[model samples]
Each structure stands twice: as C-alpha cells, then as structure tokens.
Target: MSGVKRKHVTLSLNEKLAVLQRLDKGESLQQIAKELNVGVTTIKDWRKNRKDIESYTITIDGENALKHRKTLKRAKLELLDNALWMWFCQERRKGTPISGPILKEKAIVLHKKLKAESEFAASEGWIDRWKNRHGVRFVSISGEKLSADNEAAREFCVKFQEIFKENEMLPCQVYNIDETGLNFKMLPTKTLAASNESVTGTKLMKDRITVAPCSNADGTHKLPLFVIGKSKKPRAFKNLNPSSLPVYYRNQKSAWMDCNLFKSWFFDEFVPSVEKNLKEKKLPARAILLLDNAPSHPPEQELVKGDIKALFLPPNVTSLIQPMDQGAIEWLKRRYRRKYISSILEKSEQGFNIFEAMKSLTIKDAIYTIAASWDELKPDTLRKSWRKLWPEVMTETDQTEDQQNNDSQEIVKDLQTLDPNVLASEVEDWITECDKDCDSYEELDDDQILAAVIETDNKETANEDSDCEEDELPTRISHTDAKNAFDIALQYIEQNPTSTPMDILWIKKWRDTAAKSRISCAKQKSITDFFTK
Candidate 1:
C-alpha cells in the first residue's frame, strides 16, 4: 500500500472500478505508487476512500408505505435506481450490452410525470438518469413497481407460464423470433452530466459492422425466415437518396439501408429456402413470426394484407420472450466479427477478397465463432426489462387458442428451467469458456505469405515457358485431359451414374471424340442423339 493518504478524487464509476480491480489483484505496489505517482501512503489512503462510498439501501417500514405512498422516499427512489442499474448490470454481465438515450426517454417518462407532482422527487436523479444512454438500449423502466409481481403481475406471469407449459415445445421447437434494424451507421455515446474536467472524456465508438440478431432462446442455427433487402442498399430506408447521412455515413459514399433492399431477397430468395426445408421435413406450414412496431419495414397490417400469415408475438414482450436474443444472434455476430477481422489479418494481410474469404470458412466454423459468446447473451440478463414488460404482454391477446396453449406451455418450461436461479453462475461459466478461446489464431509470416502471392503473380511466366523447356519426356497432358474429361462423364453417370445401352452408343459416340472435349459440347452431342422424351 502507498504511504500517502489520498486526496479527494472524482473519477467515473468505471475508473473507480478499474482502480479497485487493480488493487484487488495484489499487483505491484510500485506500479500503484507510480500510477498515482505519489508516496505509497497516498494509495493506502485511496483504499480508505472506497469505504466512504456509504453503502445505501432503501427499505419502507411504515404500515402502509407500501399501500398509501404515491411517491417513494429518497432512499426508496435510490433503491429503484439501484435495481434498474443492477438490471442493466446483469444484462451486461452476460454480454457486453449497454442501454442508450432513447431508452432513457421511454423509461423516464413516468418518473418525469411523477417528479413534476411529487415533493420527494428532487432527491431522485431522475433527469440525470433519464439522460443516460447506450448504443443498445435494451432496458427501460417506469420508476414504478413493475406490476408483474403484484396480484395482477402474478396473473400475467401465470398466463404466459401456463401457455409455455401447454405448448410442450420440446426444447427445440420453442423459438422466439424478432427483427432489429441493422443500422449502417451508429451514433456515439455521451454523458448525462457533462463533468468538471472528468467523466471519462474519452468516448467509445458505437457503430457495428454487422447486424445484431439477439434472442431470448438458446442453441445454434435458430435460423430465421431471413428477409434481406435486395436493393444492395442498407437494410431499411429506401426513399432517401444515397447522400443523406453523408458525414455520419462511412466514407461519405456508402448507401443507406432500405426496405426495398431487403424485400426481394426476403420474399424470393429467403422464403423459398425455408419453405423447401419445411416441405422436406413435413413441418407445420405456419410459423410464429415475431415482429416489431417499426412502420418502415413490413408492418402487422401488411402481413394480413399480403396474406403471408404468421403468429405475431405480443407487441413489446418479444424482446423478453423471443428466442433470438437467447445468445444466438449476439454470439453469431461476435463469432463472425472476430472471424472476419481475423480473416482480414490472415488471408488478406495486404487485402482480401471478402466473398471468397468468407466463403472459404465452413458454416460450422462460423457457428462456432458466434457460439463463443452465446451463453453471455442470456434471457435472465434482461430480467429487469422483462419484469416491466411482462404485465403489458399479458394484457394483449395475439394468439389463437392453439397458439395460446403453446405459448403458455413454453412459459412454464422456461420458468421451471430458471426456477432455482443459477443464471449468474451459468453466465460466468460461459464467460470462462469463451475467454479461453480468445486470441487463439494461427500465426503466419508475412514473407511466406508474400512469397505465395509472388507465385500467383508469376504463373504466366511458367505457362509461357513450359512448351520449350520439356526435353523428351512423354507429354502426359493428353492422357490427363482424357482422364479428367472421362471423370466428368463418369460423375454424371455416378449420379445418374448408370448409363443405359443407348447410353453405351452415346458413350461410344462421345468417348471416342467427346472425351477429348468439354462436358458442355459433349452434352450437346449426347442430347442430339437422345430421344425427345
């Protein structure tokens, strides 16, 4: 410990945490001394500064403080703050998730209304907290008791929990689906209160290169009825011409996301593939589709109008109940982002062919990358938001009787799975496993890589000089070409590999001359001789 008693200091909570973490590690006292660049006692005194944090807890003891009080005490409001913060903390603990300003706007609306009327309101940092922001604002609260725990709350829970049980979704069949905007550009994070020469002035960047597909379910390849915007633009806003968000858009030349860009791909390309699989598997033709309230994409009104029917999830509850965020999407993204970044470093150290590079990786490899962070993305992480959201979902009816039964069944299963609450421990376990895979990459020498590039660049020289250089060796080129040509015909036979007797005539007509030519030309001759049928 440093000898100097520390002076009063003001640092962001993160900075405080960093200092505490370093101190907890029992690392170099000398390093600590050098950091504060003061006497050893200064750091020692700083440790004492942590004790002054005055651990605060709010508890209402009046006979009817629980029933009659319209507003909460400073301590009570502080408790709510702690709860919301912890709610977010749990979400973050599972994965690196954060909330943002728009969420603050929604979450603060009630507290704002309450603050305007209540005398105890000044004690609550309502405005400061409301101004809090996150790039991924997944949680918000009304500063009121999330009614799901009350008698009304209990009914709501029972409803969904009952539905979850009735469905008997067999683990795999129970799926939560939701769509999110894959923003082409992201905004920067800022502080609620601009600090006095503090507040971690260094800002963190917000944009993500890929889409975030988070769900409340577990496992891999809960592949979606993927809807891609075909327009080769960004995924949502089409009417805005290319240069609208110029300064914010990368390189000032990239296209905006559009509904048009994703429509054709979703309708034509994606649906056909999913439908094909459903047909092959003999699955029920109808699927439960979770949708958001965004008017920009296909709205719920459009679903009925278009006759492309799907079971809509309860409006806002999808974020809590939907399986997409159960770690699948986030993991998918983490894995892909890491692999993509790693690939850029390895394959195209100079520059890579993006399509060819991504294509080279197996689908499973891509899954593994995403799975790496999957566990950290858990449903419990969003429990705070879910608690607030549950009652609202219960009030809405979006189900047929059968659908209701299935949804009820799934809720029971989920609650039973989470009954004892081992979520924090499970998330920690996942983190340990995931971190083990960090920085595991193959090393490649630049010179060796450059040499391979040189070989490719010089291939023309080898081809030009090949004819004159061969001494008197038997040129096996004809034999190799003949064997390759026969292999193609043989392959066709292998699949339809059994050639008929006229096929023998075809082979004879073809093999004698066709074996020397391309499969395309040989196919023409074969077709010419075959019956029209």
Candidate 2:
C-alpha cells in the first residue's frame, strides 16, 4: 500500500483561502498538510503565494472563482477588465443601476482607451462570461431602498431568542460589533445668525476615519476601538508609536473596512480581547459575535473558532435590530463631537484663531479624542444599547432613554456655550451627520481601484512615494523628563487638600513606574567602576 502511487490532489481557490485563514489562526503548516492529505511543501507554496491568491479572489467574481481549481488566469484584455470593474464598483456604490448593455458599452470604451492590440467585440456571450468571472448579477438592489423589513426583523427576533435558549448564553458571552464613519474634522452645518446679517458657510471637510466598536451584551468588555485611516503613516503620527495609542490602527488606500482587515481584526484583536475578558470573569471561553451582513465582514464559517461562533443579523433589518446601531455609535460620535468642540473653544481662549485651530486638528488629536470618548461611554449605556436587539438581557438598572437624552442635551448646551452661533438643533444634526453617508465598506475611486488591479496583475506591492512636504517632527520627552513630570504630579497631589488617598496612590504608582523606566535607561558602569565599588 505504501508503495502505491499517490493520487494528485489540487485544492480549489476557495480551499486555499480557507487554509490561509486557518494558518492565520495559528494552525501549523504540518498540521494543515496532515488534515488536507497534502504535502507540507504544497501548503508552503500556497502560503507563499497567499497574496496573489487573495488578490485574485477579490478582483474576480468571488462566487465563480471558488470553483476554480487551477491557477487564476489573467484577463485577455487586462487593462480594460480592470477599468470596467472599477467603474462598476463605483457606480454600484452610488446606487446606480447598471444594465448588461451598459456594462458591455463601458468595456468596449475602456478597451479602446487602453489601446489593446487584439481585436475585440463586446457581445452577449462576453457579457455573460464577464458577469460569471466577476460575480456580477442582475438583481434588485435592496440597499438602494434603505428600508427595513419589519416582518423579517420579527422573525429574526424569534430565531435569535431560540438560539439564546438553546445555547443558554450569558449576557457577558454575547457580543455585537459594528463600524461607523467619523468625519473627524467636520463642523456643524447650521448656525444661528442675526436677521439683518448674512451668514456664510464653508465647504465641509470630507476626511473620514472608520471606527469599529465592539462589546458584550452585559457590557463587561469593550474591545479597543479598531480605527482605519487612508495613510499608512500619517504625518500627524510623527514620533508616536501607533501601538501605544488606545485604539488599534490600520490603514489602506481607502479608510474603509474590507474583508481582509475585518478577518485580521477578528482573529488578532477581537478573539484575544474576548478570551481575556471571559477568563477574568471566570466565564467559559465559548461566546457569540453578532455581525451585520456588510460586504466588509467575512463569512461566518471563516470566523468560527473552537466554542466561539460569528452570526449575521437578518439582512436589511440591521438598522432595526443591530445593538451597536441602536445608540452606541451615536453616543460615541456625540462624545467625540463634544470633545472636538471643547478643544476648539480652549484654543480660542488661548488666543489662537478659531478656524486655524480647527484646521490644525490632526489625526493624532482625533485618535486620542476617540479613545477618550469611548472610555466615557458608560457600561450601562452599552447594556441599554442591546435593548432593541436583546430586550431580555436589559436590566432595570440600565440607563433610561430620558437620562441618555439629558446627557446629549448637556453636550449640546456645552457646544452652544462654546459657540454662540451653534444651535441645539444644529448640534444634534451635526452629531448624526457623519453617519448619513456611512457605508461599512469603502467605495474606491477609479484610480485607486485600477491601481490595485494593476498591482495585482504585476504581482507587486505598492511603493508609495514619500510626501514632498515633510511635517515637523514631534518633540521627544526623555525618560528623565517623564520621571520629573511624574514627580511634579505626585508633589501636586500630596500637597492638594482636596486630593483623595486613591489619587495620591495613583500618582505614586505612575511616579514609580516612570522612575523604574528612568533607572533602566541609566548608563551601565565600566569594569573598573564595578571593581572600585
């Protein structure tokens, strides 16, 4: 039997992707090879060509590509295919209905523009194959309607309740995760003005950052915010370690969440954080993660681990049932806006021009504010957010709607105080404005999409040139300086009559930590000095 010739087995592209996902979850190459009945070198090769495989999966028709057992073939007219796909994606994102004829016409135009030497005709057969290759379909675009199915929402509620009963899941064991867009630099669109005076408005700042907030039903654990931005290394992050920041930062050409980024976050950040939280609480590692059916989110099968599972909410009912969408994201944005407005007010009082101060607001500033705002989100607020989705989990002690409204009203009043022109209505409008055009996935422009396709075609990583205008380097603080600052803080706390014992203890702890770091950085003694000592 051992001498018999072995049959050759070729894994499909989808199978390779699954293997990569398992590898990402820390499965060893040898173990995967054993499970798949394939050679270790085969697995190694797949892992080596992981990028190309993944790129092909994304750029081509996702569904049909799954059936492809061999290496993915490049399109005959690569440039035209790339350009047409980019146009299709952009148009679809804008809710434009694209017919088959329209797509064919676009492809023909792109082929001509690309100066392809091969004679080509865009026929019905070409359109059919193109659709199959790219996973295009003529289906009603439900997203364009922007309405929830109440019946579906009710049915899903019943199904969810059944699952809850069957699993006997604890509140702390169930989690909901969602992403929201934040126009960090946006200001109120409306303002009060004198009847006789004319009001002027400036163009709205469209710069956006994506923030994903996740927490359990009981609110015992809140994952560190997963933030996505456009720049890999923003000028604002100079001299600062991104990992040291409270939020987890990632970047791409578009700051939107994609399947790859989400997959990485799930395995790396979400799983580890939840495992730690469950362990701390003496709960079982088994848990559930609820996600929406956004294009950015990977399939549930890819997200499953031992005893933990990811489930999708009923489609088109996310707005009606998603726990995070209920109020958590809105609360975060409101707090962030309040912090942003307060900063502007502080800078104005310090004699800086108001518009200049706003303009100077950097990604670094926005990140810290986002972290602080997330921290300020009360556990009760988080628990209450689940009321719409999991009413049974809500405790009587959870914050009431009136209480939340009062909190929002207070922030609005603060904003009004900061700017006399700011109206309460305008503040409320501004708080929710960032979300108006927010889609879980980013809509890439033609150039960005084409560039990605081209890179994939060339099997190369992007080599972005450095910005010509270098930002000023941030001032560095030495360990000694940090230690001295801690000492000053301790002294202030010790002398303050109003300071509590806990405050003094905290200052001492910080001072000790800083002191230890400072001592660790001290120069080592020479052999002569050691002998003399």
Candidate that would win on TM-score: 2
The whole-model lDDT of each prediction reads 0.35, 0.74
What TM-score would each prediction reach against the true structure? 0.29, 0.70
Task: Report the C-alpha lDDT of model 1 over 461-498, residue by residue, as the tens digit.
Answer: 11221211222223334534765676677557656845
What candidate 2 gets wrong by more than 4 Å, as runs, is 1-146, 158-173, 189-207, 279-288, 293-315, 356-360, 399-403, 419-422, 434-441, 445-451, 456-473, 495-502, 513-533
The clash tally of candidate 1 reads 58
Q: lDDT tens digits, residues 415-488, model 2?
A: 56656677777667667665677555765555555565566434222122222123354678777787789889
Worst lDDT run of 10 residues, candidate 1, spans 186-195
Model 1 error, position 323 (Å): 2.3
